[model samples]
Target: MLSVENLVVSVRRGPEIVRDVSFEIAPGEILGLVGESGSGKSMTSLALMGLLSPGIDITGGAVRLDGTDITHLQPHQRVARNCGKVAMIFQEPMTSLNPVLRIREQLEEAINVHDPRAGPERARELLDMVRIPDAGHQLNAYPHELSGGMRQRVMIAIALACRPQVLIADEPTTALDVTVQRQVLGLIRELCDSLHMGVLFITHDLGVVAQLADRVAVMYAGKLCERADVGPLFRAPLHPYTNGLLACLPDPESGNAAFETIPGAAPRPGAIPEGCPFSPRCNRAQETCRSGPVPEAHGPERQVAVCHFPVRQEAPA
Candidate 1:
């Protein structure tokens, strides 16, 4: 299992930005981290990948892959010791990939980095694994030569070239249309089943989470608001934030009425409320909730929720 226990992050000499976050993903399972912009979704993935910005650092927490703690490994140590054990597919492939290099060179770089013997041939295998059409011809194509979805396939090919036990995909489908999005999601699902790689999928779309994640964690203001199996989370979201997110999705069954909107925006790390960061916007928040750490309710389904009074029903009437 991939475990993130009591993770905390802070800016250099600054206040905490990610607070006591924790979750786990077993091999072959996809754990979705869903939250709005600046909710620390990307930060959590960055921390796991040893790619946090120079000004930010993980202050407390332990990240483990199948029982081996790697939270404190320096970047070089991660490359030397955990090369194939962990890999990340970034949010934007166009920016992540080398624009000047052909797909073959890029994939070969990732493969031969850990195993020199596994060269261009292994690169071809990776492209085939991600089901890229015309793998042989595609390898010679540059990033600009491929479509957005095709570029993303190349990105996935690189991440899998190392055969990681854990894959952190940070909104890999954010730039694609619905059709291409489904193809990428399907490819990920197929890989998980075939390779048994645990995946941490980060996204803002609850609909995507429902379609792709076995379990989902809701984040807000750098705190874990709620987590549960996707079925239960959508059926009965415990936190007001989770309910609010679900409310915001346009329901075709409802004939496109104005999408429900949360009253206040998510708070920034430096501007969080004194106690519950979401208190300023939560309708069910009370005076006590406004001044204390929200009590967490833990249960059998692996559901963990921080709420004084959670919403058990849909946010809208």
Candidate 2:
């Protein structure tokens, strides 16, 4: 339902935050964008939604929703055609929702933006769709009055108010406790299945992606390092970085000890390494890895890995 090609985004005084990243989401499919913090995941989401702050620009590439190129459309123009069609659930619900407005008012505003005639009843129904209890009673409550999970539900309600075709959730579960996180994610999956909505769910949490995504794209230092189906990725990740991430996940079979962690930190914007951005930290890095350009397409399904020495699956031990 949405496609991004060679999408590059950069800040005025910084190096590119997103570099030539590309992916597509089909209707009813959830494409999870996974990476470490500062890997440009959130920036990519904002760029796709035309929500980037001032001083950032779409320096290159195209964003097409259902075949129409929307890369250069003015912000207001894009909003008119694409805003409601592609909604977003931001990472932090508290700051995302208007603190001054009651839950009902915020939701009603969202509905009115797309369908001005939608009344209070329609707003309440949207709340019910998100499974929020006693929608009427919660309507008059301001953001502060609601718990973290409840506020998130309200955000979901608002994002779905327009019956959006695509939803871009940027770390939608980051602030909630484990129980609430599962609920929010389950609600999202249910809604997507029921509405046939496409979603680009951005997160650093591999566990979340493992549960929700059909396909996973791993990003590093502003570029896509690997993209694969969830099963293949978990079973036999082809990139060293992908393997590193998977290795970090705690294994119950390993006695619940802290798992192996990827070495080093994500590079800051202007300080990215010359070759593979992950080269400095990658255990498999060789001289060629530090000099060659990122790899292009490597498999069927257009699975791309930007590593000169993409990992091959090992034999069963």
Name the top lDDT candidate: 2
Error of 2 at 97 (Å): 1.5
* lDDT value for model 2: 0.87
Report the lDDT tens digits of candidate 1 across residue range 1-317: 88999999899989788889999999999999999999999988889887888899999998887788889775468667854367888778668889999889888887877667874578878888998888999999989989888999899998887778889899999988889999999999989989999999999988899999999999998989899999888887888888888889899998977879999788888888877788899898889987856788764477778888887653456
Reference-based lDDT, residue 266, model 1 = 83
C-alpha lDDT values of all predictions: 0.86, 0.87
**Candidate 2 per-residue lDDT over residues 36-122, each given as its tens digit:** 898999899888777888899999998988888877665457658754367889889878888898898888877877777876699
Residue 196 in model 2: shift from native, Å?
0.6
Q: How many backbone clashes does candidate 1 have?
A: 0
lDDT of 2 at 269: 89
Candidate 2 segments whose C-alpha is farther than 4 A from its true place:
79-84, 256-258, 297-302, 315-317
Q: Which ten contiguous residues of candidate 1 have the minimum total lDDT?
A: 75-84
Clashing pairs in 2: none
TM-score for each model: 0.95, 0.94
